[model samples]
Target: MLKLHFAPNSRAQRSLWLLEELGLPYELNRMEFNPKDLKSDEHKARHPLGRIPVLDDGDVSIFESGAIAEYILERHKNGGLKPAVDDPLYPEYLQWFHYCEGMVMPPVNTIVVHTLLLPPERQDETVRGQAQRLLTRALAPVNEAMEGREYILGDFSAVDTMLGHAIYMSNRLGCVTDEMTNLKAYVSRLETRPAFQKAMSA
Candidate 1:
């Protein structure tokens, strides 16, 4: 059985969602989000950075949601979630999968750091403004890509689980809007998934 170290409202949610989607039985080692819990020496042994998602499978351990998602799909043989290389959209799938973390999350992280996460004295308005602008620009392409499609690759995939978290962060920060109708609808669709709901509120 897999052992997942989880913290509510963290990247570990993505891994939990993936596990639920895969219907894989695992132990959820829920932990507090506070530094005392995450920064403990025991936690640091699993992850040098003491991150929320540290998956212990037998003798091997994995961290980072993207890598963990891929690991699950590869082990479970769920090609629908992650298409094989022979598939036409395989390249595109990899692109969007990586895009979620690479393009989307950086500014989202910046916005989060400047806005709610950081203390008033540490927050920077200039950085916030710049990140907001960059995040908006980053979303415009996703909005356009999502036009006439329910999902990124026109079918549900693991990439959505990866990127959806970033979009959720954007939405929570008021980055999503009515003008981005397609993106909003995309998020709405993701929200309706039972696995998503479970991971979020479970």
Candidate 2:
């Protein structure tokens, strides 16, 4: 059985959602975020960066939420979490899957840095405004792409799980607006999924 090192309300939640969606039986090794604990040491061994959501499947070990999502989808290709490789929507899946990590995360990280990581006195107003502006601009393309589509690939795929984090975080950060109607609706649609609800409540 797979062993997943995770914490609730973290990126690990996405992996848990994927496991639930696939109906895969896995052990959830919940780790507490203690700076001075054996579990923290073990977690560091599993993930050099000491991040949550590390997957250990026998000899295989992986980290990073997007990579973990893709790995699970690939491992269970028929699980319906991912489109077939030959499917026309596969390209969109691949694009948006990477975009969630590459494009969206940069601005989101900037927001995190400016809003929380930096001290109020040292926080640069210009940097915060620039990050907000960039996030607003970057979100437009996602909003347009999701217009009239129930999901990023026009079907529920790993892209939804990947992009879901961005949409949810953006909403939490007040980055989402009426202009992102499609994206907001997309997030709402995802929230209705049983797996997503389970993950959220877990």
Candidate 3:
């Protein structure tokens, strides 16, 4: 059986959302967001970094949400989250899928670390402001891309699953706002998905 080691509110939610979207039966090993919980010797065996959303498939183990999503999609023949290589949009789909972490999350993570995770003594106002601006700049193209488009590729794909989570966190951190009406609508659309709801609560 597929066993997913997850932590609520972490990037692990991405994997959980994907699993729910695919209607796959798997074990959810929910964990707390703390070193004592994830940084244990046992957990480290699965992920050297002890990150959440590590998928254990019998003898194989995988970490990284994007990798996990691809792993699951490649295994499920009925999974239509990715585009076929023959499809013209396949290249664009691949671009957006990886763009989630490559472009979007770094600044969002910086803001999150500065505003919420870091202790007051360690938090830097300068870093927070810089992250906010960087995040805004990074999101500018996404807003432009969403103009008159439903999804990144004119239809729902796994890229949405990856990008949606970043938008969700960005919204929470005020990185997304009403001025970006298209992005706001996009986030709202993602929020209403039943699988997304399940992952949010899971």
Query: Candidate 2 at 106: error in angstroms?
Result: 1.1
- Give the runs in model 3 whose Cα sits over 4 Å from its true position: none
Which residue runs of candidate 1 sit more than 4 Å off their true CA positions?
Answer: 78-80
If candidate 1 were superposed on the true structure by all CA atoms, what would the RMSD be?
1.2
Worst 10 residues of 1 by lDDT: 74-83
Tens digit per residue, CA lDDT, model 3, 64-99:
999899999987544578889899999888887887
**2 or 3, greater by lDDT:** 3
Give lDDT per model, in order. Answer: 0.87, 0.80, 0.87
**Whole-structure CA lDDT of model 3:** 0.87
What TM-score quantifies how close candidate 1 is to the native fold? 0.96
Runs of candidate 2 with Cα error greater than 4 angstroms are 33-39
Residue range 17-49, candidate 2, lDDT tens digits: 888878889898876544443246666798877
Q: Model 2 lDDT vs. the true structure?
A: 0.80
Model 2 pairs in collision: none
Candidate 1 residue 161 Cα shift, in angstroms, is 0.3
